[model samples]
Target chain A: MKTCYINGTGCISTQNTFETDFLSEVTINNTENVIYANQPSYKEFIAPAASRRMAKGVKMGIAASSKALKDANLTMPEAIIIGTGMGCVEDSEKFLKSILDNKEEFLTPTSFIQSTHNTVGGQIALGLQCKGYNFTYVNGAVSFETALLDAKMQIENDEVESILVGGIDETGTYTLSLHKLINLVKSEEDKPYSVLNSNSKGIVHSEGAGFFVLENEKKESSYALVEAVSLQSSLETEEVSDFIANFLEANNLKISDIDAIVLGNNGDVEFDDYYDISNSLFKNTPQVYYKHLSGEYNTASAFGFWIAANIIKNQDIPEVVSMNALKKEAYSTILLYNQYRGKDHSLIVLKKC
Target chain B: MEALKQELKGKIIEVLNLEDIAVEEINDNDALFGDGLGLDSIDALELIVLLDKDYGIKLTDPKAGKTIFQSVETMATYITDNRTK
Candidate 1:
């Protein structure tokens, strides 16, 4: 079996991820319950004519994927896979609004055509003229992990030499309001929002896109090796410890073998207990968390994945994302755990190349 | 006729989302497809809907759009003759 290496990564998050170094300039925003992605100019990656009808999610995906491919020094990939939770939702809202306002008449085809969940994958393929096996996964919070697993399996089996995988989710006006009404978004009273040790019941909602290029061979640009990925639909708070143990065991690893652990603690008082269990289990390991920087989104785990990749590549972890005061002599093997509202649990292991 | 042509240019620009293209850049004789304004089949469908919604011109034959949408001059003429609203 061939090894799957993360050759390149591109991330667009609430922080200045796209244009800056690895978490060089970090801001902890607890004031607003909802945050927006720090958008980079798309003119460099997408043509104006082609981008006129694209939604924010689509533009971000294109830009991030372009950066990932360029960073990997590959112009084309044999496959393109995307994982998006909401998936071009702004266009979905626009199309729905036009239907309601115009009495289902005079509806333009642009918004309706761009509203599909596979729009990002299709658009990326179109831009690259890549007619390869393009797929999009929409399995809630595990969407990104699912896509990563698919690409990893294909590369391991020698099905493809290189693949582009990404996870994208964007905030829409109507959808954000609906989430707020349902109390999925943190209330104003929960100001000074912190992802760690927060008493809030809801999340600080945000949007972002992260893309990576995976190849079969390790190169100088390789960031890390994808060791394994595990997904579960649901897990109880008590079962969390055993879950990580069993996963590491399957990968011939133990808790002590992990150098650092990237946790998905989104500060939801009700569900963060899952991380608490792992926190105690890996108390001595270097701990890292990113939701406070990226906010809570379905594919926010992708941002966490990006952070882990950079940590392995740079051989140093940014202090801004450090959850504990612990330090590691070397980050050889790292584990990533993410869940949302106590469901769609995922565990991914990455290692230095 | 001049006012209608200018109106057609503006509407086409707005509806098609030609953000980089200005109204002054589009001449009445410029082709709306292929070599001229570079409009595609998708843009053609949008123009069809625009005609129906704004000018009350429902084109029964899709083949006629090839000629009717040749230029701003052609579209203005077609709307002037066929507009029911």
Candidate 2:
């Protein structure tokens, strides 16, 4: 298989991620258990008429894709692939509520139209006018990884030179309430949450959009080469360490070879132990966690990918994202691992040029 | 007639979520779509619901809105002429 490289990346997350630097201006979110993305000025990236009906996820995806294209210095991609676990939840909730509230009489089409899972990808293709191979994945937490694997496969097979890949999820009022009722969100009193050591029942739920431009050819703005990507639907918490080790070994790498490790620690009391196992295994190596800054959403691992790519390219790790005091020398071969509710575990290996 | 036009403008603004636009900015004779107030298809759907809910007018065919929703004047005339209530 041919090598695939990350040419450009963009993110809009709970923290100030749209900017160039990562983890610089982010505030340690203590209050407000439901974290919201520090939104980019949508008017700058989207025309008012097109944006009027878009849910938050669509806007974030489009804006992030636009930035990725601009940074990659490419106008059009051969394909656009998107992954969204809870696609357009706000629009879904709005339409459903209206249907139930008004007995389905005076409901409008805007919410219904935007409620589809592929709205973001469709709107992006509409904006770019590129009717290329478009696909959207919605397999719970593995949604983004599924998209990544597809993009990688396409690149290796010489199906397309460039592809726009991304993941996005927006907060929904009723949906959040339901998750809270199901104990999916941290309780109200667990306001100041910590990921490393937390006595909590749920994750600090948040929303974000992370997009990347992947190409077969390395360019000036290329961050790193995507060596490998693998996903497991279910793995015992005890077996996670060996699973990661085997994944790294398949890519011709050892645990010691990884310059840095980025873990998805979403502050979930029951499930965060997955990340904890990996952290304990890689204790001596430089470790980083981003769910605190990006908040914990289904596709938030896309933000971790963005962070790893940036770290590889810039060779700088902001203090805010550091899980420990350890610093690295000449960052290279960064590994990213993420999962949600102990499902959809994924491992990605990136190498600096 | 003046009261009806004012009410229509406010309803249009509220239904469409035209956040930055003001009610006074929409004139009774100015085009509601395209070049005048610059509304689109989605806004037209919202208007369809608005007509149904506010004035007891139901437009089963969306194509009818091209002329009915052309402007505040046009919408008011259609509502006054065809309102079920």
Candidate 3:
């Protein structure tokens, strides 16, 4: 199969990813249990009237995708693929609240129409006037990985040359409340939360949108070569080593071939072990973790992917993201592994273009 | 009748989330959609709910909204004739 090239990338996260230099000036925001995205000026990217109806997720996706296309110099792609855990959640809450508030009498359609999981994809297509194959995946943490795999497969098959793929999620008031009540979010008193060495029961929840433009051919701004991607719906924490070994072996690589390892460590005591147990297999390898900077969300791994690609493109891993003192002679190939709560584990390998 | 029209403008602005538009700017006979206020189908649905919720008027057919929601004058006239609460 031909290699899938990451021609462009854009990220809007809790750390001013949209307008900053790759964590150069990142200030950890542990003051809140739930962090909001560091937003760009939406008026520059969207019309005021159009933006008024958009939830943060949709707006972020639009801005990110637009920036990605401009960075890749692509006006329109052949396909648009999106992955999201909870889609248009603000609209979902609004629609549901109206249903209850009026006793099912006077519900409006604006929020209802925007609440669909595919709204981001559909709206992007509408904006671009690109009437091509579009899809949205919503399989929990693996949602973004699923879209990435599909885009990769399509590019490898030569069915499409260029594609827009993104993973986006937004916070909703009611949704956050539910997560807090269920202990899925870090406790209120857990502010100043440290993602690496925490005794917390849950992660600091946040929101973000990460988008990438993938093409069959590498461009001047191409970030990396997407060598391989793998997903496992369920895996015992003990089985992670063999799972990675098989993936690396299939790609004609080995554990030593990996330059850096990006692990999803969100400081949930129960699940940080998923990342910690892998430490033995990659003990000598330079390890990196980004949830500390990006915050823990379903598609936050997409931010990890952005970081990995940038690491390969620039050949320097920011000290802010390093999990340990280990270093490589030249940061060439990067392997990113992410999962949530012992499920939806995905492995993606990226090599310098 | 004039008071109802003025009240409808405020209600429309509040319900539809038209933050940029002021009540004084909307003429009683001006169109509520397309060329006038630039409202769309979605806003029409919101107004449908507003009519039902605030005036006890039920509109099951969406096409009926095209006539009743033509302007603040028409909406106020409809509410004065059919209001239940």
Which candidate has the highest DockQ of all? 1
lDDT tens digits, residue span A179-229, model 1: 999999999988888888899899999999999999999988999999999
Worst 10 residues of 3 chain A by lDDT: A270-279
Off by over 4 Å in 2: B60-64
Interface RMSD of each: 0.7, 1.2, 1.1
- What ordering of candidates by DockQ runs from best to worst? 1, 2, 3
Candidate with better lDDT, 1 vs 2: 1
Judged by TM-score, which candidate is best?
1
Q: Write the per-residue lDDT of candidate 3 for residues A1-353, one digit (tens) a residue.
A: 66799999989998888887777679776778888898899888877777778888999999999999999999999999999999999999999998898898777888898999999999999999999999999989988999999999999999999999999999999999999899999887776688888888899899999999999998898999888999999888888888898999999998889899999999898888888644598999999999988888889989999999999988888899989899887888999999899999999999998
> Per-prediction DockQ scores?
0.83, 0.74, 0.70
lDDT of 2 by residue, A280-326 (tens): 77888788888878778889889999989989998977777888778
lDDT of 1 at A96: 100
lDDT of 1 by residue, B1-85 (tens): 9999988889998999898889899999999999998889999999999999999999999899999999999999999999999
Clashing pairs in 1: A30-A193
